[model samples]
Target chain A: MAMVEIRDARKVFDGGFEALRGASLDIEEGEILALLGPNGAGKTTLISAICGITQPTSGTIAVGGHDVVKDYRAARNLVGLVPQEVNLEPFEKVWKTVRFSRGLFGRKPDDALLERILRKLSLWEKRGATIKSLSGGMKRRVLIAKALAHDPRVLFLDEPTAGVDVELRRDMWDTVAELKREGVTIILTTHYIEEAEALADRVAVINRGQILLVEDKDALMARMGRKTLRIELDEPVAEIPAGLSDYGLRLEDDGRVLVYDYDTSAERTGIARLMGALAAEGIVVRDVATSQNSLEDIFVGLVHDGQEEEGVA
Target chain B: MNWAAVAAIYRFEMSRFFRTLLQSFISPVISTSLYFVVFGGAIGSRIDQVEGVSYGAFIVPGLVMLTVIMQAISNASFGIYFPKFIGTIYELLSAPINFLEIVMGYVGAAATKALFIGVVILVTSSFFVDLTIQHPLAMVAFLLLTCVSFALLGFIIGIWAGNFEQLQLVPLLVVTPLVFLGGSFYSIEMLPEVWQTITLFNPVLYLISGFRWAFFGLSDVPVGWSLAAIALFTSLCLTAIWWIFRTGWRIRS
Candidate 1:
């Protein structure tokens, strides 16, 4: 069974705003799944429902095969959440803050485990410091330590590195990677597409309160990711030659270069054919370069398509 | 039961109480002493006695009740409110523990704090007046019940309040006035027949009357009525909390 299973989860706030509309997903055990979405795309709401922080208006969510609503304690016990907000008691010491989370999960006092978590997050040296006294990055680390204190099977990081410095973000990525090595199932929501591309095995895209798509990160990129070939001409031409019309190439740099887009997975990219056609037309080529589309392009395209569909509807 | 969770929350809140030792402990003690100087000294010089009990001795239960009620409400309300305000309440809500356990942690801690202050006030009052307890066990019971019930009420208030102003609204406008009119410093019998009847309508009056009975065996109302009044109040607060959690009210939303 999937470590976390969300079946058609829907959440409507008090103001009648539907935050999650029939969102369904299955997160496998011991894999990093990145939930990618724009703001107000219901990422946090979905995490909240799974964590039992907020009840869904309809449908169900289960963690570790236990229903989040029906068997909340068992489900919640297996999951730990590091919320987007850095909310900690200002007067509370880092050690106590982390220890409190472990205790809140019905876990027995394990000072050794807490110490390990704090040390892993580089919080041991600052354990005696109050939350208010720490820097922003250190406070975020404290949140991670608290989440890991209970030794949960699955962890949810909601925008864990949203506003951190580059160094801290890299540090958090390493921490997440280490957690995954320990057989922990990780679900992270992020606005940074590169973060997902770098860390996720599977990528789930959400938009306007619905899951747009869920696929293996590499598969999604391969299936939808496109590559562009840019050819620099020996001399400038006013426009594209008619012979290259079948390739659908566009002239750029004042007609001195031609750009062709093709699927990397295609059996024949038509690049050789286009080049032969260009030579047959006496179009001298100077240099050629190929670039693959990044995850950001695919993400933007998906969200844009979703928005356009909504607009049309 | 998630007893560990309860203890963690309890210890967390208690730590905050201890962190503000001057405000939590010494302030109440000083305030209790000030009340003695004002009511027992100034007022006693004129009235001398009320129902054959020295005026100084007569207000001890009232003073303890006043401090206990206020402390219970403020401590419990702030204990819960601060988490909600700081957004740390998400941790509590998402924990494996149920609402009952959450309430047990916060309300339990609040009551404990109030109980401590109540005892301190009692001790402080003794230094100002010759004190006697006609029913020591009953006094303890009343004090405990008051602490618990008021703490529960404060929990509800903390959830209901959206801002600092609203947090203080009930305690300032409703509770303090009710306590003053509930015969905290003077007996309801001292009021006119019409006002005395009106004073019985104040729920706080029963708490004070029963508490006074434990201290001096003098009560404005029967001890049974006082006990019933508190039991009813506690039940109402519990019912409200049950509905709040069931409906995913302010705290959950």
Candidate 2:
């Protein structure tokens, strides 16, 4: 069964900012879904609506079969959220903060469980330390531990590694994967396309409060991405010389190299024809390299396409 | 209405407040002592007795009430305001605890702090003036009621405030002025008849008067009337707090 189902959700703030516009999606149990978007794309707003922190302007959201509005307690109990900001009580001991979060879900205090959670996050050594005294990366881990303290079936991590260093980011990603292995469904929003591509089972692209697509990660990568050939010449040329313009070639840095961007979905890339044209233009290529499609490429293409559509509208 | 959540949050919040033991304990004791020294000692030298009690002893209950009110409001407002400042309110809101439980936890902790300070001030004031409680039970009841009511008021203020500046506005500017004008240092009878009638409109006057009556067994107003007014105000403040949490005013979305 789906752990979360958002049906036509919309949020219009008091100042008339429409953060979410009829966003609908289903999150299955035990799946890690990555929400990819730029800033102001409503990722955080959507997560807030799902967690019952904010009421929707219109539409319905249910978590674990409980409506977020009508049965908030049950719904909230089924989900835990690690917000983008570090918000623990600074004066409280680390252990107390995690344990208190569990109790907030109306769960009974279990020392063994709390200790396990702390240990898993590598925070047991500092259980007695105050939150304000912990380091930045440790504080981020504390938030994750707090969210997991209640043992919710689903976890929402909104940019969990936004400002963290590389080493800490990898550690957090590994921990998230481990949690997914333990059957906790995870929904994450990130500006790091590689993080999504590396960790997400499914990728959902959202722009301007609208969802562009949600697809299986591998299939989406295979279907929409493109490849590019970057040709560097021995010498810079003045222009494309008019004859090579039909190959969709872009001249970079006054024709130091010619860039050819082509869809991988096409039958042929016409690399031989392009080379023939470049040779006929008396441009000798010193080095030629091919690049495969990456999540970042698809993201840029989608965003650019979105912008063009908005421009037309 | 989850007692366990309320208890947990209350315990955590209270622990945080007490974590700075020196600041929490010393600040109130020193402040209360200064009030006694400045008001009860310096000002009491010239003022005559009120209702057969020395001016210093007569003002003891009012002074304690003022401390409790100020401490309660400050503690509660800071408790909520700090979380917001650090952006931790998202975790609190996303938690399974309902609005009532969240309010109960923070405000409950604040009330506990105010109660602790109130007791310390009362005990410390005994050193300055020959104060006596004519009705021990009434005194305890008024202290607890005033602490809780003012804590609720502070919780509302914390929610309404978007930033740190706004947090200090109500407590320092609005509430404190009203409290001082409520006759914490002097009886309303000392004022002209018109001002005395106007003082009755200040809610803190009824709270302090009810507490003062419990101490000296005498007041410018009837003891029962003062008690009734405080009780009504407590109920009204509690109802408004409940409504604010229910509607998620300023805290939600």
Candidate 3:
């Protein structure tokens, strides 16, 4: 059975802004699920609802068979969340912050376990330092440490690497991977599709409070995602010839480059056919390169299309 | 529901206050002492005993209550406000800790600070005035009850407030004015009959009058009535705060 199941969940703020519109998804036990979306895409809102931070306008959510609202204690006990912002008591020491977080979950203190968590997060040395004295990256780690303090089976990270340095981001990825190894189901939201591509087993894309798509990472990339083929001509021309119009060719930089976007999910990508057609049109390609569409490109394309459609209406 | 969690959060918050050491512990005491010197000593020279007690001694319990109330509000409000401001509240909210645990932990810490300041001010008052505790246990009980009550009230204010300025509004505008007008500095008997009748409606009057009763066995209101008012206020405040937390009002959603 899935460890976390959210069904037909909806969230409408007090101002009548619908943050989540009947969203639903299930996260398998011990799997990493990455939520991808633009700002105001309801990623955080959905996560908050699941975490019981905000009650859903309508729907049922359960964590390990415990209804989030009816059995909140059990549901909350099963999951941990690290929010986007770094919020800790500035005067609190790193160690005490983590320890107190554990106790908040109604857990008994185990010095040995706390030490292990601190050492694992590489915060053992700075455990005694006040939160204000730490750097931003250190503060972020403190949040993570606190989330793990309770030893929950499920973890949610909201924009975990939004403003973090590359090094820390990499370290956090590794730490997340480590947590997954310990059989902890992880859910995360990120604008960086590469992070999702790198970490998630399943990906859910949300836009304008709607779930655009949710699919296996590889399958989504292969299916709804597109690929691009570009040809750098040996010389610049004024315009594209009419003969190549059927190929949906786009002229760039005074026609020095020709670009074709094709569906990767098609039985045949038509890359070879497009190249042949370009040659027949007397467009000598000096260099040809094929680029698979990244999750970012798909996300931007989907959201932009949605916006344009909204504009038209 | 979790005693362990409550204790841990309590200890952590209390330690944070003490960690500042001089800034946290000494600043309030010094400020309260100055209030005593200026208002109790300097101002008392021309004013006779307002309620059958020396002017200096008459303000002692009120001043102590004032100090306790201020510290309780300041410490408790800031305790919750800082976490929200810095964004650490997400961790607490997401933690397995229930809302009750969160409130108890924070209010407990706030009460601890109020109690500590109440004691320090009580000791400091001895240096300036020769007062007696007519009922030591009643005084202690009243002191703790008042501190915890205000601490709980402060926690609600902290959670409801979104900014530092908002946090200061309740203490500076509401509580301070209430304390000043609550008959802390003067007896109700000195006011006109109309105003004297109105003074009975001030909640802080009950607290101050009750504490005065505990000290000198004299008060404007009946001691039992004051005690009942305080106890009811504490319970009511506690219930409201608890409900706010449970609903995640302004704190989470």
Candidate 4:
């Protein structure tokens, strides 16, 4: 069975705001599943529901085969959440906060394990420092360390690098990679496609409270992805000529370039036909190139598709 | 129940309480001393006695009860409210513990703190007046009940309050006035018959009267009624908290 299973999870908040609309997914164990979405896309809501912070308006979520609501203790015991908010006892030292979190989960004190996790996060040096005295990046690391204190089966990082600098973001990515290598199941949500591309084995695109798609990152990019063919003419023109008007290609670089978007999977790409038509129109080509869409383009397209669905519904 | 979880929360709150150790210890002692100077010395000189005890001694139970109840509520309310304010409450909510365990941690710590402050005030009061506990066992019972009950009420208020202002609203606007009017400093017998009957309705009056009875063996109402009143309030607070946790109201949503 999947480590975490959310089926038909729907959260209609007060006054009919559908924060989550029948979202469902199965998270495989021991893999980093990045939930990719934009703001107001229900990423935080999903984590909240799964972590037992909030109940689903309707649906069932199970962690390690334990239902979050019916078997809350068992389910919550299997997961730890690093929330987007940096909400710690400002007066408490970092080490004590982490130790307190472990105790809260009914875990016996293991100073050795705690030390290892803190050191891994680069927070060991600041263990005696009060949380409020640390920089924002260090505080974020403290939050992560606290979540890991219980040695949970799954760790949910909700927008972990939202406000982090580039250097800290890179550090966080390295930490996540090392944890994944240690056989820990990590689930992170972010709008940064770069983070997802760098870390996630599988990516789930969520928008408007629904999972747009959940697929292996490579398969997702290869399937929904579109390829573009561009021709740079030998001479510049203002617009496409009448002879090539039927092809309806995009004109850019002062009409010096012609771009055609097509599916790579299709047998007839129309690239050869387009090139023949351009030649017949006496348009000389200086250079030819094809570019596959990056994950960012795919993410934007998915969000746009979800918006169109939002408009329709 | 998870004893470790309860202990964790309890210790965390206690550590926070001690972080302001200087102020926590000094403020109550200073305030009790001032009350003694004003109510016990300046005011007592004119009024010889109430119920055959010296004015200074008569107000001892009243003053202790006042401090214990207020301390219980404020400490418990702030204990829970700060976590909510800072968003650390999510960590608690997502943990493997239940609501009862959470309460045991917060309310337990609050009661302990209030009890500690009550003892300090009692010692402080002893320096100012020749006070005696006629029934030491009964006094401890009364003190414990008052501490736990008020701490529960504070927990409810902490969860119900949206901001810091609301956290203090009840203790300041409702509690202080009730304690002052509930025969804390004076005998209710001094009031007219109709007013005396009216004063019986104040819940704090029962706590003060029962507590005073423990001290000098004098009370405005029967000790039984006072004990019953505490039990009733305790049950009410429990029910409110149970409902809050069940519905996941305010905290969950």
Best by TM-score: 1
- In terms of lDDT, the poorest run of 10 residues in model 1 chain B is B17-26
* Regions of candidate 4 where Cα sits further than 4 Å from its true position: A237-249, A268-286, A309-313
Q: Which one wins on DockQ?
A: 1
Pairs in steric clash, model 1: none
Quote the positional error of residue A244 for candidate 3 in Å.
8.4
Tell me each candidate's TM-score: 0.98, 0.89, 0.89, 0.95
Q: What residue pairs clash in candidate 3, if any at all?
A: A87-B87, A87-B88
- Tell me which of candidates 3 and 4 scores higher on DockQ: 4
Query: Each candidate's iRMS in angstroms?
Result: 0.8, 1.5, 1.5, 0.7
Q: Model 4: how far is A120 from its true place, Å?
A: 0.5
Which of 2 and 4 is ahead in TM-score? 4
What's the distance in Å from true for residue A294, model 2?
A: 1.3
Which sections of candidate 2 miss by over 4 Å?
Answer: A229-290
Better of 2 and 3 by lDDT: 2
Report the C-alpha displacement of residue A262, candidate 1, in angstroms.
0.8
Question: Runs in model 3 with CA error above 4 Å?
Answer: A225-265, A268-288, A304-313, B28-53
Q: Encode model 1's per-residue lDDT on B1-253: one tens digit a residue.
A: 8899999898888888888888777898889888889998888899999999999999899989998999899989988899999999999989998888988999999999999999999888888889999999999999999999999999999999999999999999999999999999898889999999888899999999999999999999999999999999999999999999888789887
Tens digits of lDDT, candidate 3, A1-313? 7899889899989899999888888889999999888888899999999887788989999999999988888999998888887777777788888888888888988778889888888999998899999989888888888888888999999999989999999999999999999999999999888899999999988887777777899887888777788889998868878767777878887788988888877898778887777788787779978888888887788788877878932
Per-residue error for A118 in candidate 4, Å, reads 0.7
Clashes of 4: 0
